[model samples]
Target: MVRARVLRGVDLDVPAGRLTAVVGRPEAGKTTLLNCVGGLERPDRGTVHIGADRITGLGDSALTRLRRDRIGFVFATCSLFPTLSVEQNIRIGAELAGRRTEKQWFTTVVELLGLSLLLRTRPSALTAEQRQRVACARAFLNRPDLVLADEPAGELDRMEAAALLGFLRMWVRKLGQSVLLATRDPFVAAHADRVFVLAQGRITGEVERPTVESVMAAM
Candidate 1:
């Protein structure tokens, strides 16, 4: 018989309107943590909450609707539709959430991400960083209560990654949106307001006002 546990008694809290980071190596169950919090995975034990909603025990349809209504996700890969124009890609996010697009907010997000000129372009026509920004725009356009980004800049070069993280930090602060970002990079964690270091299947430590050196030590 074999028993495998991907996460063990994981406990974490992401405060409202703040950027929180989960710092760990690639296989440290960071993604599992995010999935559980996002209600994409059920925890064997323990509660998961987003705002006031207890998500761990939610049924599938309810979880789906909750995620669509209250959370936005940005994946490590640029998960944009190759066939859709950048403008269309963003609009789809609102449409999927049963929202009417708010023009001012949409324009502001596009401009902040430096995508104002690329709205007519397809994902195939954009650079890797640009594609990621489009994905960010889509995630944030609906103004969900929480945003979960799983190694969002993992594929970018150092400069590109920094640029993307900087944009994320700035906009999250500006909009007062809560965020939980999972990454292995100490540099990335440094941008977060708080960092939790995860090892094996559990959270080992945390740092507030994180510096790269502090995160490295915790990890």
Candidate 2:
């Protein structure tokens, strides 16, 4: 059997209350890195820390608890339950964690994401952008310590993608949330406070306060 190593010596920090991005082409180990950090996949070696707790060697149950209480995720696909209304979908995160949803925060997230009018609608009824907003709102509703977004705006059109990125930026700046977004798009990378360029399973370069041109150059 051949063992493939996807990420090699990738060390980076996601500061609190900021948006950090990893930009890379397809098969550059971007998704693998996120999975390891999020505790969905355990690395062969290395450490992952969330706040003061080291999660690298934790057991499955411990990792589950950590994820439930501290981490949020936004994937390329807006993975909402088709049977549930948007409001139900958003609330389900809290429900699964056995936590009560704070009414004020819930309302705030809904309004900020422009989903107030669509709460009662099911995921299938939404446009691509609207469904993604619902996903964003659900991820932020808990105010998790860290949010991992993997190609979150990958399927949206230019205008929709920009709007989605703007909302992500607003949450980080105004609400003191931390986000680590992984994408192949330079435009998406530009929205981050700092960008890490990945290639062939390694971080090749970094650009602080990245512009689209700067990120493209780094790539």
Candidate 3:
């Protein structure tokens, strides 16, 4: 038995300790591309490799395990357990992956995201920005090799979006982790170390040290 690939001949590389942005208009297959990279959707052609593992060839169970252990994902929507305290929610990823949270790293991430004071609060009690930060914490708490974020700042205001992007970039550099962020906003793409422009299901161009103008031009 075989499964058909969902994507065409798309090639991408997210370098370690760098934040790469995939920018495109809505319905331009940005989510689909991100999903394939995260192993949520398999491409019909090409391969997706995270670190040393070629994830595209793995079976469902293996892919699931690999994603759980080596990758983290943050989406546009807030994903949180309303009844769970922030600390409990943040630790869920490590627990599910059969790993323990490293105290120092956890502390560092919490402080970096300004989540220390909100540790005891539930998701329902937090502001939109705070909840999103908590989601970021959960994604990074396990210290995964790579993180895939799909429009993570879509719900935020301009200032909050800028802050979130800054936080994401800082953490990627500090932890030497790779990140693939998908977005339609040039403002958001400008925060990336490099940006790839996608259009009509294909990569149209690449921009280095992207600015809003550069990213828009690339698109």
Best by TM-score: 2
Mark the 10 consecutive residues where model 1 has the least summed lDDT.
93-102
C-alpha local distance difference test of each model:
0.89, 0.92, 0.87
TM-score of each: 0.95, 0.98, 0.93
Deviation (Å) of 20 in candidate 1: 0.4
lDDT of 3 by residue, 103-178 (tens): 8988998999999998998889888778889888888887788888999999999999988888898887777778
Tens digit per residue, CA lDDT, model 2, 1-219: 998999989988889999999999999999999999888999999899999989999999999887877888888885899999999998877898788987888889999999999999989989988888888898898889999998999999889999999999999999999999999999999999999999999999999999999999999
Show the lowest summed lDDT stretch of 10 residues, model 2: 69-78
Write the residue-wise lDDT of candidate 1 on 73-133 in tens digits.
9998858988889999988866776778778888898999999999999899988899899
RMSD to truth, every model: 1.5, 0.9, 2.5
Candidate 1: where is the Cα deviation over 4 Å?
A: 1-3
Clashes of 1: 0
Q: Could you tell me the lDDT of residue 69 within candidate 1? A: 77
Off by more than 4 A, model 3:
1-6
